[model samples]
Target chain A: MDLVKVQLTNSEFLSTGIEKLDNLLEGGILKGFTTLILGSPGSSIEILSKQLAVKGKVLYVTTDETEQEVMDAITRFGWKPEHIEFTDIATKYSKSVLSREKKRVSIYEQRSKLKLKELIEIGSSGVMPAVKAQEDFLAIFSNSAKTTSPEKIILNSLDFFLSMYSQEEVLRTLHAAKVANIERAGVLFIIMTKGIHGEVFERKMEGMADCVLELNVIQKGSTFERFLAVKKMRNYAKKIGIARYAIDSDGFVLEMIERIM
Target chain B: MTNSESYVYNQNRIGLNENENAKSSCPCITGIDELDQKLGGGLPSGNTVLLVGSSGSGKTTLSMQFLTNGAKIGERGVFFTITEPLFKLTKNLEKFDFYDKKMIESGMVNLIDLRIISERLGLDAEKYTVEDASALLEILKDIADELDVKRLIIDSITALCYRLQTKEMIRDFIFKLGSSLASMNCTTILTSEVPPNEVKYSQYGIEEFIADGIIFLGDVDRKGDLIRTLQVIKMRGTNHSRTKSAMSISSKNGIELTPLLKSRV
Candidate 1:
């Protein structure tokens, strides 16, 4: 039997949707690398992340917002919502909580109607059986990533996961996701709030990421100024730069990048 | 014929009410004649039987045959598949003449995907905690009760137990599930996977101890041919032949058993 060998033609770089930013990095972000995006509140990182969805098929894992809410924001900036699939963790999380509460209420109502002997038997068991822990959102995210096999993967925030799960668990999942992205030659963009997870944890995340971008918002008098910084680019030291950016009517507009010599 | 009428006709053709064996108090007669004869009737009613086997050894074929046979005799059955999707399983089942799509459609034999059940119950964890196991058991019990399911099959309990971390949890889950189903007079067949050459009947080693019966299915190489075999390791409340029998699966007959011929090689 003759064997047919198939080859995957994946580009070496993926554009961040900004021509100036793409030019500074020679092409764009490297393929098969995890890009960590750090942003303070009101830094317009969400818009920047949404702009990346135009590159290819995107699996937008939204832990911070519902799928509808994210899509609304995307369309508000005239970005096409096509080719983007969402694993809505926020909606699923809320639904899970509501279901758990309902189960608790039902159990309580049943226990209230129980006879003395039955109640005593239950008391002997100490705790009610079949009360499972909260569903593992990390596993769900991982499953979505594997099944979807998107060219561009976006996790809208790590802070929600960190708050829900332990640091070790979150790190393990992040490493697994990173390895999966590398094997598939896909770009993964993970968004997180700056400074909330502490300096040590932040540094560890930066070490894991192949590229790190920080979106900083500064207060100047009563107005706010937004700047996008290419803090770390693996194997490209000369590409480290900072750029003033704003979320204009069209979308995220990069003014200029001052290359850090 | 309409689907309902077709199902009724098929059930009648299979001699539904004529099987005195099914009407017996103790045994739930599987429709396979030779195997039922070997068991002196069939599997014990309300007992949990571990159908342990290696891959492609006719375990699934035999289990489906059991459920379809039960459905023919007015005993409703449900198959909870953990590893395979329902569509894929049904597609595969379409090859067997004993398999009737009408049986599934009529709800006489229910096919459920455990993954769907887990999703519905919000069990997204990689490993099921003890509480998750208990919740799963409760859900299973609810399903059995709701369907009035007389026969239940969990195709490959190995997959289900993979999510259940500890041996203690496995044992507890199986024990409680067995007790609950047995109380409902639901005879269960939990398919278990083992390595081809392993002596153990189950992956976790605790299922065999908890189960009331064991049906071991395996394949042996004899004269350059791999022959599937089935042996009754144990069956509670019945005098069953412990001898191994050669088994063959075909689209025409589903699963057929014959005496194992001694091989000189």
Candidate 2:
């Protein structure tokens, strides 16, 4: 193996594995930071997220849905049992952990509103890392430069937190994401979103991320086609607005060709 | 007293990673050899393909071609036929000399039998709602993994889009599906019917307007003779054949292609 490592430049960031998208960012995205994929509903955000699952593990949190349709989507992306991971936080883990934590050490400064700390304490308290899952996640992240920091992480598709959880919970999750940035090492989050929450999430993720991209499917002429854009990339020269993406199907061979917007 | 509390989760979580070379575009599953050749090795595995044609214009047959080809090539293929019953799809395949009895038995070629599935899932009527799409998709996912389905042929997404109430809901649903399917590495083929007058613009643009590739099949009139034509409207990542080629539907083969211009016999 050549000892020379090729760091991607702003121009070379987009590798045409997709059908219509080109590299719209400065480089191969700011590695190890949070990135939001903001899109209207039915955009290819999940598709983009699934395609980007080569390095890190994806943790998808759905608040609005409990659909087999969504779960099956991950499997369709060619993730084996070893690769596909699922956690039902709202019912089993999320609500219980927080509720239990709140009941015992429930410190109500005013009970009218709470800080992000209270939110985090409740959500993460009593939530043990199902040992098997820990082992699996470690195995996923083991092959890397042995350092104090991790390589990458993902939130997968989370549009439900907007309606389901408190505003405090949402902020708490964002705070948690910042912690994940340090804990997970090289982490680039692909947060799938829809509508207004997408915008809100994007703003929060922007403060937390090193890069941000968008995937929009538009009706151009008489065909249903997709578009991709590199909205922001920190510490790199970049293009702005929407980039038209051509989605192809070579299975991990997505080609992001040009910036259209 | 209106009481509000804060929330937080300091869970150290790992998640799905971005692809190493994640720039590849996903194209539709083009089962036709010539079509694949002309359009650069079929459609990308993760993107959607739209097949638009008038009724009895080989739209279903083309979708079948996509599924059969995926099966013959050792990729798990799923054919979710919304317009026809399972038996009809099987019977129709027989006309094209395409059915592999072994594949059917071995579960390599999965015919979702959307018509029967509709009945089973209580989606029997033509006037189903968008809420039905999610449930139906769940069923599709079950078959996709159990059969290790890599190539998906959804006979139509147009019907679902049309039956839905609002554009926002449909958009959100499709975004979820299109992105999810792409992540699944699915070379999906979705067929949509076009009315004769609305040839320029499709009824629901989901299939034609949202897919990676667009192929139009229509019957053109040569004086009193009605000849069919196939045209590639758009293929984002790869080069597509611009010329409109003549096509025919036969009892034995289903869909047979012919050049538009005269080839002297």
Candidates in order, TM-scores: namely 0.53, 0.43
lDDT of 2 at B3: 30
Off by over 4 Å in 1: A1-261, B1-24
What candidate 2 gets wrong by more than 4 Å, as runs, is A1-261, B1-31, B118-131, B251-254, B262-265
- Per-residue lDDT over A1-261 for candidate 2, one digit per residue giving the tens place of the 0 to 100 score: 111124243332322223223334433444345667676666756656655544334444433334254556656765442233333333443454354344332122312133322322222132322222212222222222233333434444455445445656666656666555645544545465645655565566666656667666778799867666676766653356555555444233334445433
lDDT tens digits, residue span B160-258, model 2: 666666766566666666677777787777777788635753565544556677788887776768788888888666655677788876665556675
TM-score of 2: 0.43
DockQ of the candidate models in sequence? 0.02, 0.01
lDDT of 2 at B173: 63
lDDT of 1 by residue, A1-261 (tens): 011011112267776666666765667778898999999989977777788776678999999789999888888877775588999999999998788645432322322423222432332222324546678999998889888889899998898899988988999999999999999999999999998999999999999999999999999999988888889999989889998888779887888779896
DockQ of candidate 1 against the true complex:
0.02
Per-residue lDDT tens digits for candidate 1, residues B1-265, read: 7999988885564443335435546578889887876777688789999999888778788999999999999999988888777777888999999999899768798887777665445464477877667767876787677779999999889998999999989989999999999999899999999998777899988899999999998877887788888899998766678888999889999888998987876
